[model samples]
Target: MAKVQVTSADKTKINTYTFFLVSRMDAGKKYYVVSELEHLTLEADSSKVSRDGQFVGKLVPESGYELPQNITIEYGSDVQKVSGNLYSSVTGEINLKASWHMLIRAKGVKASDFFVADHVKYQITSSENVAVVGTDVEDNATWTVTDCIIPATVSKDGKNYQVTELGEEAFIGCKKLKSITLPAGLTTIGERCFAGCVSTLTEMHCLNPVPAAFPQLFFHDTMEELNNSSPVYDCVLYVPAGSKAQYAQAEGWKNFGGILEDGEIIEPVVGETTDSTMTITCNAFEQATGYIVKVYEDAAKTRLKDEYQFDADGKLRSSSFSFTIKGLSAGQTYYIETMAVREGYYPTPIIISQNTIEAKTTGTATANEGVTADKPIVCVQDGEVVVRSSGEISVRIYDLSGQSIVAGKVTGYGSFQLTKGMYIVVAGDESYKVVIR
Candidate 1:
């Protein structure tokens, strides 16, 4: 393995450190193919935390080279090797390397103007010197392919250009799309790109270990809506070995079936996550306008537990930040899932998994009908379940399965003593799963 040096950013002080890469384009390779290195991991000092939860403050080339804005550096915020995108690690070590942009003509191309080359359809995005791929009603009828490989460069009009953006709805409803080979330069995948092929896509061979973003949505409108049906990409997403973690955290990259790196399976690819929080980090963290974090219940996701959203105001953390989820349902597990976000919004996906973080403070109360209560609501404290409301109200205790374990009625205030354990208490419309010791 070769070594590279970059500076680090600490929370309250200025310090310099080194980082390394996690994956390469080919096996036994010492140098990186710039295209394949786009999302390569940049390892950080394990004993390091960013001055702003990131290490890219002064992270420039050790001697010369430039760290372009498009380039990303990912590192594990912890020893687990779960890398944060765009040098967005809070711990551990990972590096993200991006190369030059493919230019405008590489953005999107229409299928109606398709050009055929090597049994694959192609279209030039124009005189910008590159070929692009895009779709509107994707005339898959003209070219029916069950398995497809998009070459790094396609020939058109006696000229060759690199393949970049995979246009919006590239294969919106292509049921026969069993597998696809995306080139290393694919940066943008338009909305609803894979609208209805969640089941048929068995394998995805992505030459790029990491790119700018990925936005794969099915028939559902939003991620939460999709969560109500399918929580992850059923197909296995294959990428370069050692780059699984970066792919996992890239926008809309988490798939329940698995994100495969060099044939090995890594289930539920996600960013850094803890019991009660999911963190979103990236080299482009500074460029993000803002972010939205929504959490859903493990079962019947329609029931939204709570949400946290923030804009990229000056108050935001510099490197990476974590969302502390609240309102735990008794016996209920919350998955810190993300909505299918667009590429321009943010760079990566949150570590989607079970939320184990607990909240001790009380939150706004909701009645059985979801009506807000301004006064006291419900909370678990002093080995008991406390319910308070300004008007007539009731409380019910349910287990993880939604089966009512106990019930209580109260008009003003009531406290039900409890044993040592956890319970889901619903006061009015608001519900909270809490622990009492």
Candidate 2:
């Protein structure tokens, strides 16, 4: 068994804690599973201050070893009423300023300290021991490596520890992860470390030149979409310069569709466009803090006409990305270019051809506030159209044949009963289509 050490940081940050659980599953062989214990605490002016010490319930033990579930916690002196998870509680979704934190414990196993970075969890077994990168506490769309640390390290109680390896099933069932950047000091990648990331993962970077040896089925599939449906999968591996041949010969590392030197930048995909706006979205570059969308008047891309910036903590937003460039002339053809800007990486230029819609000369004045296309606070209930906003709103209903079914003004909350099929409800400038069943 691997020797484990407990540090004071382990208990202090238990609300956002990370630790390892030694799960003994029937056989004498022992397995280790990383546990990220989450709990919410009330805050006074942004600092966490504790209340009473009432035990809620022990974290679902490692014997079950399931995905972490939310534990309810209360604030102030209201122990009778509790809020749900950290996100919901903090955001007032649960109508409370208090949130729950994680509680993790094992009956007979040694506990160790852990920390988190870039949404990835790391358990510290020894301050000087081999660094082991743990799995993510929650699923994410995209993830980036920590700030270019050779041995990803964390400081707690005035001491620093290195994160040097990937734990077992570190990224299993991360269906939305589209891109990743591996650390430099990593020496071992456990089995199924990148499994079930089939939906959108298309590229990754390995900073280590002669680094970790990957275990069997490092990128295997556990999700149904990849296991029984799609057979085609492609991923590009970018390694350090002059080490492409070394990685090509390494087991499991050669499975990528292509390997390249780490400095090349790829183009982003172009999405929807409007008369005055065009949406360009892309995966985050290895260490980029944000992306710059540059619009050009010509295909040469040398002349920059307009630019927009999107910042997302150095990772792609939602494993997908999108940002609109507004103020372009309508009915005009424009060239689009994207540059993923990073601290230490070269910004590569990506180009796309785009055409704006014809400018609207005269129509109902559109309101950009309150409502949005495809999502509106209006809904039909009790045979009436319920406007959810507190302000006055003008609404128009159109049928499939472009015939007007109803038009009216609603204030505070108003409703109109209408038989349903497929109808487009126009509120302000936003139009919502509904199929009444």
Q: Quick one: best TM-score, which candidate?
A: 2
Please give the TM-score that candidate 2 achieves against the real structure.
0.36
Off by over 4 Å in 2: 1-112, 130-151, 222-233, 265-437
lDDT of 1: 0.47
Cα lDDT of model 2 by residue, 76-190, tens digit: 3433322222222113222222223322222211233555554566656555644344444444324443222234556656777665777655666666666677767677776
Best-matching candidate per lDDT = 2
Query: TM-score for each prediction?
Result: 0.33, 0.36
Q: What TM-score would candidate 1 get against the native?
A: 0.33
What local lDDT does model 1 show for residue 387? 69
Task: State the C-alpha lDDT per candidate.
Answer: 0.47, 0.48
Q: In candidate 1, how many clashes are counted?
A: 31
